[model samples]
Target: MDTKSLIIEKATILFQQKGYKSVGLTEILKACNVTKGALYHHFPNGKEQLLIACLQVLNEVIMTDIESIFRRHLSTKEALLSIIDKLIRDLETEGTITGYTFSSIVSEMATVSEPVRHACSALYENIQQIYSAKLVTDGLSNESASAIALLMTASIEGAMMLCLTQQSSDPLKTIAKLLPKLLKDI
Candidate 1:
């Protein structure tokens, strides 16, 4: 990765774990093995700008993965199960849920910055749309698909938080089991 990309990547991981307020430019610099000058070169506005960059990176990665899962699975239920399973695996392996960045950042900086709040909202909206589109393709009406998609997104995020706090994947596993049942009427 280039220096800027490296900084974003390292910062994303650290911010996901440590929250925006907790991580300093020094920590990000050390993580990326870059000097302050290099970081400032890419993110002239400093930490907030760098954070916004990190949100963009998170959006691309998370959306691409979700889109890919939907493409690969013919069944919407299976696709959703796959997503939940992936979440469980991610939590177990990396301690990250889909919106892990949002969870960490919102607590600290979201209230203070419009850009950060906007980016986080956009990420969630985009994720919901991805799920809604997949459901529509699977033969649900736009209204129902969108509604269910919202439910899925909320439940998954909630479950992810539970998984994080409880240090167990049970909540996500439960979502994996129960969410698909919501699709049965289709």
Candidate 2:
């Protein structure tokens, strides 16, 4: 991979394990085996720039995956259920949902860093839009579809957080079961 991509790959792991503020340039440099000068050459603004790059990379990967899921021939509800199942499987493999999410980092840095906050916010909005479009295509009214998409997204995020903190998949399964019934109303 190129230096910039390498930096982002390594930083994603570090930031996921150790919040943005806790992981410094030295740690990221050491992990990537890149010198301070090399890091600066690729990211002139230092750690902040690197963090933003990591967020962008993550956002693209996740949004693309979600979009592809929707684009599949599966029904909208099936696609949504598949997303939850995939997330559960990923968490089981990763041991922590944090690795698959930048939400924790956004929560930590949002108040202090406007750029990071905006990057995270934009990612979330994209996700909601994707789901809203799918729901509308599935026959729900635009307003109801949008609202349901937002609600379901928020619930999934919350369920993931709970499962991660509790170190149990039961919460995930519980939420999965609840999701279908919840969608019945929409």
Candidate 3:
């Protein structure tokens, strides 16, 4: 990776593990093994700028995964259940999930930083949009698809948190079971 990409990659992992507020630029610099000048040379706005880049990459990676899952399955229900099952498996093996750094970052620094708030909101909106599109493809109306996608977004993220906190993947596993049942009607 180039210097700029290296900085962003390191910052992204730190933000995902430690959250936005908990991580400092010094730590990011150390993680990247780059000096403040090098970091600032790429991100003049410093930590917040690096954070926005991370969020952008996060959104891209997450949407790609979701789109791929939706494409692989014939029904929205199957895709969703598969998605949740993957999350459950990841949590069970790794004890933490990837492509979900925004949950903590948004809750941590949304009020304190406008860029952070905007980036996080964009990621969330994109997630819902992808889910809604998949539901629509599965024969639901736009209105119903949008509503159901919103519910799935909120529930899945919340369940991920519960899984993390409870140190059990039960919440996501429960979601995996329940979401398919709910989507069966749609």
Error of 1 at 119 (Å): 0.6
lDDT of 1 by residue, 1-186 (tens): 688889998998888888888999999999888999999999999999999999998999889988999999987898889988888887888766644436768767778999999998899899999999988988999999999999999998888878888889999898888888899876
Q: Which lDDT values do the candidates have, in the order given?
A: 0.87, 0.84, 0.87
Clashing pairs in 1: none
Mark the regions of model 3 whose C-alpha exceeds 4 Å error after superposition: none
> What CA RMSD would you report for each candidate?
1.6, 1.5, 1.1
12-46 per-residue lDDT for model 3 (tens digits): 88888788878988998888899999999998988
Per-residue CA lDDT of model 2 for 42-94, tens digit only, reads 99998889889998888888888888888884566788888888888888887
- The alpha-carbon lDDT assigned to residue 85 of candidate 2 equals 86
- Cα deviation of 109, candidate 1, in Å: 2.6
- Top-lDDT structure, candidate number: 3
The TM-score obtained by model 1 is 0.94
lDDT at 87, model 3: 90
